[model samples]
Target: MAEYIMAEKNNRMIPEEDKIFALNARAKKMSEEVGRDKVINATIGSLLDDDGKLVMLLSVVKALKGLEPLDFAEYAPIGGTTDFKKAVKKAAFGKHRSSSFVEVVATPGGTGALRNIVANYSKIGDRVLTSDWFWGPYKTITGELYRELCLYPMFDENNRFNKKGFSEELNKLAADQESVLILLNTPSHNPTGYSLDGDDWNGISEAVKEASKKARITLFVDAAYIDFAGDEEEYRTFLPKLEDMPSNVLPVIGYSFSKTFTLYGMRCGAMIAMAPSEEIAAEFKLVNEFSARGTWSNSTRSGQVLVSKVYEDEDLLESVNKERAGYREMLIKRGKAFSNSVIEAGLPLVPFDSGFFSCIPLKDPAAVSKRLEEKGIFVVPLAKGIRVSVASISEEICRKLPGMIAEVIE
Candidate 1:
């Protein structure tokens, strides 16, 4: 018998352990970064009130109040409310599909839909493709499941979509894996507030088709901000992927009422999967239903009921839509102001056209964020650039962005 001796080598993590720790640490750091407070957040995604409070979409809340009658005491079905699912489909993919062909499931939020979409399409170690410009949560949600978040370049130096870079990335992923996933966020992007142009959508579609020819790839579109993008018809008409509803190339959309109707804390959203055939759609429905059961056990039943009720009421929806359009245009004003100041200051501009987020390329993202915070401004720092949440920022706050960056530079 030999006595065991304590050794430092035993404490060292194996390769798998090291990789897990890296992921854990990255997620932890991100959670902390997004939780910071702000006197004037030039880099926020949520809308703010005139008093600098987070704007609660009162219309949605009022709509939700009617659902109190539904009772939380009752356990909702795994598939969620039928009315809610129908509403989601009407709002998301429209009536393009054969009525029986369309299917949807309630999810905790758009993010829940995202997880469900990914789970239905992929397995561990599968390559998930998204634009280099993307929501931070993609890494947390996809990576934790052991999938790789592959990034294709989104915009060029002028902040326009880079088709070649996108094509290359898709081709590479298709060649390397049996299946690949591509996530497209529009009519606007988070943290950048940009949407794809007409030409860009065409390029992306061809790229998706090209990649699909090589390997089985799913296109997941996050149309979370479709309500704020000014023109729904333009988006609906152009994103041929949504209208055509391809079969070999599956397209799943994550629709969130959280932003459009301003129901943030309520957490209401749905996932709609468009498969080539009803059989495949049914298969996805089963996975999504199971995901709903296992994940959150159905989204807020009351919230779903409330939104459905609102959708059915044309008079109510029209008023809400008009008011929402007003709020959305203000965001455009605020963002343009920020862009103008950045231009005047001779700072680099990150093209933002669609959603609430935009970024400026900086030498050090963390340093720039700190300096902005010191000036009573707060923002998000990303690998490629500094993300600005234009919807939450006021014209006054937006005007100060360039000066804040100048101070950081000095």
Candidate 2:
């Protein structure tokens, strides 16, 4: 007889260890053995100060500490507290709020929002589309939902957003499926740090608008790193473009407080829908709320209260933004340092604007990452490249890494 199995058959093959977490664990163990100064662990995607301490916004911390027991201990409504929904919309849209009917549902994080989208928008065995360089969890989310993840090349020969490839894939998928869910992570895309400009957004809008003629289109914008991308208001200009699309083309924005509010462990975010009509927006809220109840019963109340408290008070909001802007400047400085070093070393890097991460495309990324590990340096190895977390490292490390990676490649 075969050995008894515990998990459902479909779940049995899931990898026990997450690649990033496993690498991070190894890096930490090494740090314990030697010292932190000797190690360069860029495996995690969290903001860290120069001394390698996790950076938390003082304003956010104060607000959290001030919350009364009832505010945090009591259960929030299934969808989210009313104030949270309002605050999340404000946080996500800023001054570029959409003109369409809108709805919001609280999710554990951007991960949960993506999961809900895949669960509701696409049928099992259907394909979900995104750029070639995307957050790895996208594949995980789609796979767990029994859906396929497809990709279009992110850049063309000119080293720009590949609008043609995106259109081709969108048209192809729309033709085959009843509905297509396209995930676009912009204003600081992971691993590559590429943000879509107005023109790129226009191209996407046109492509989806055209593709919607063939099938229903759900345009999911994952703005997980938006706050850290650049000037907050400037990075949000593309948001208005997400509005006024054909009724068949639905725009969904995944907003995460993890990065925006430095509440990573709080597991809080929201899925926002911009529908052409009130009926569609209501339908979105109902369906996503049902999904939320079935999966994670409710998001953390404390996190919701933190957002509400901050947003409701203008003085506190300004303080939080000011603190966050300072960190954003630090990230920009680090990104510039790395980009300059890469150019000086003649290292081939994927096009990066402003974001927490950047990628160096190459063959055998895993092997190269392993070699770097031996040198007390750790970075994530993707299918096509090695990802370096600029947010987690010091400027000195940022400046030195390109040369070290170049030497390793040679």
Candidate 3:
């Protein structure tokens, strides 16, 4: 009698749930359902506007302006270039420093910095808080690190910040008095497209201060779309105030060059940690350096150098503004078209001001998404809603959304 059993190898014998596989499977199902043509592809995070591209145009062609290209072929320091850091600090914080310490570490992009920051700072059981309508990756990244996410509802029907719910949640975290982590992606909320305005922004920031008084909560501001938010002058008014951030509360910013510069493939980002104590800032730098070294070693030197030039050249901002303005116009146009069509088609939608995406309500989002695809349209089906990216969708294709949606509803 021979006994046959499959032997398990260490680390090799893990369960293969493979959520990525499930995600792809769902995508395949979507493509099959939607059919070939009439596909109003409202999916992805890349540029839809062709005008703003000229902002980084000079840097691209002027690669031969001064230093050799190979000069950028080497590895940058783990902490990034002094010039780049200075420029980014200026871009993000403007001018004001009550920080005990302040410094920047170049990351692969927001994801890289977020990875390093979480690895360096958040412990296994740390309770991380963020808006319910947040970037999906935050959950995956933090969850992979075995951290718990506490979500506060983001908006109401008026499409305003849910300050009451936000305060209640923060107070709950404070009552526990544990190391609470708060992630804020304001200026323009994604998926919802709602940015804080008027007294609301002040109120929310004040509430954050209140939460800080109660417990050691790290306020991580995920400002990936800072460059894209409407009215740069209006939005930037609060950044300079970060210089006044407290020591008990470390206000770390996750910055990105992905959207602003349209260098999605460049994979460039930075983490600017502003601690009240310079001594604390120094420690963060050292730890951050260690974390960077352990992970990516260093960022691409060419990108670091190129971004530096754009920063130093004040003339570059004029081009950026021109480009940004054009992109803003396109976004507004596309968003209006979709909203109007959605209204005509009688589909309820998530409220938005400006940013990447918009959404509509649907039960069993995946199933509904499949039905819409049969009509030649694709969308991202979230748990509570479906996401649409206006940029990737064409005007002709955009016009057809209402009809297709009507078909699905019928």
Per TM-score, the best of the predicted structures is: 2
lDDT of 1 by residue, 239-325 (tens): 455545345677777899888788877788987776677897888889889877777876777777777887899877777777787
| lDDT digits (tens) for residues 153-259 of candidate 2 | 99999999999999999999999999999999988899899999989988999999999999999999999999998888999888788885998888999999999
TM-score, model 2 to reference: 0.98
- Residue 162, model 3: lDDT of 83
- Residue 395 of model 3 has an lDDT of 52
Which 10 residues in a row give candidate 1 its minimum summed lDDT?
Answer: 11-20
Go through the candidates in order and give the clash count of each: 11, 0, 10
Which candidate, 2 or 3, has the higher TM-score?
A: 2
Q: Which ten residues in a row have the lowest lDDT in candidate 2?
A: 1-10
How does candidate 2 score on lDDT?
0.92
- lDDT measured at residue 208 in model 3 versus the true structure, 0 to 100: 73
After superposition on all CA atoms, what RMSD does each candidate show versus the true structure?
Answer: 6.3, 1.7, 5.0
Model 3: per-residue Cα lDDT over 206-300, one tens digit each: 77778877787677778787767676667666654555544577878888877766767788889988787778688778998898888788887
Which candidate number would show the highest lDDT if scored against the true structure? 2
